[model samples]
Target: MSQLPKRIIKESQRLISDPVPGITAVPHEDNLRYFQVTIQGPKESPYQDGLFKLELYLPDDYPMVAPKVRFLTKIYHPNIDRLGRICLDVLKKNWSPALQIRTILLSIQALLSAPNPDDPLSNEVAEHWKRDEQDAIATAKEYTKLYATEQ
Candidate 1:
């Protein structure tokens, strides 16, 4: 068995044992290294009703490197590019071995609540965010309502 599977199994157990509000994860039965995660938007954000799905892939070097995460659902935000790549600090330079899946998901939820325009992955979204916070928030709400709502 691959070491990645073992790590993911342990992480999933930890997530289940000590659940994080607004976030949950489960590995695919066919592929242990790939996980499906759901993250509820933070309470105070315009994305409050949003339920975002994420695809996580554990690299061979897990603890030493951050897992690759992508938004499976379309998300229009300053920190997430058009391609759905997230630009979170912890997922990059700030990553540490101590970080776990639960913490990362929580951080993503927090990121939605408070986006950093200065370091944005989507330039247009960032410009809107910097120029007008209210309009940006409104647009985010519109996107959440249009794309993120559950059928």
Candidate 2:
């Protein structure tokens, strides 16, 4: 059988040993390339105090092509779609081989702090954020309280 790639192994080890604050990524035993992730919502944001779940998968090409990641927990952000897909540059056109799992996770966390209404995946959510930001934030906070509470 082929062995796990050196980069993947190294990254997995680093993730466990030197993890980013508010983010935890652990590879599954059955599939080393697949990871179960949990991101603590950033302070002062609508998602604060909530634990957001996500899934990350490193493709065969890996560093050559960015990892596939998506939110699993319910989040009311303009950049994240109803299906949990994110509209982030690094995850899309701006990705580079030099980027890493840690960086991407950090980016996702930052996105929580700053939701861009202009570039949105969910048009409805974007409209809400644009038309009435305060109301949208209130709604997001309510959702975080209702759906993202620790289980």
Candidate 3:
């Protein structure tokens, strides 16, 4: 058996032991470095009841380097671009060694609740959110119903 990195193995164990509410991370059976995550939308948010999938890749130099994360599910949000890239400070410049997978997923869930218009990945969505909060929220709800809802 290929020996996995200590950090990755420990992180995986922690995720399994103390899972974040509404979020699950399962490592690929073939590759321990890659993980699949599913995060449920926060209650009462426009994305409520939605289940979003994401793929996470932990580099060999983890803790020093942040994991690569991308949404596998299509989502309409100001901070999420068309390609599913997220614009969150914590994922980038603000990342700290103290942060873990559960914390990252929780931050993402919070992002769905309160989008950051100041720094938006989707300009049109940001503009809509800035100009008309109600309309933007309504549209988000519609998207949740249409694209995010399980068939």
Regions of candidate 1 where Cα sits further than 4 Å from its true position: 1-6
Give the clashing residue pairs of candidate 3, or none: none
Which tens-of-lDDT digit does each residue in 38-111 have in candidate 1? 99988889889899999987778887899889998888799999788999989999999889877888888888
Report lDDT (CA) for all predictions.
Answer: 0.87, 0.94, 0.88
Clashes of 3: 0
Clashing pairs in 1: none
Candidate whose lDDT is highest: 2
**What value does the lDDT take at residue 11 in candidate 3?**
89
Per-model TM-score on C-alpha atoms: 0.93, 0.97, 0.94
- What digit string (tens of lDDT, one per residue) describes model 3 on residues 86-147? 99888999999788877888898999988988899999999999999999999988888887
Candidate 2 regions with alpha-carbon error over 4 angstroms: none
Best-matching candidate per TM-score: 2
- Candidates 1 and 2, the one with greater lDDT: 2
Tell me how far candidate 2 lies from the true structure as C-alpha RMSD in angstroms: 0.9
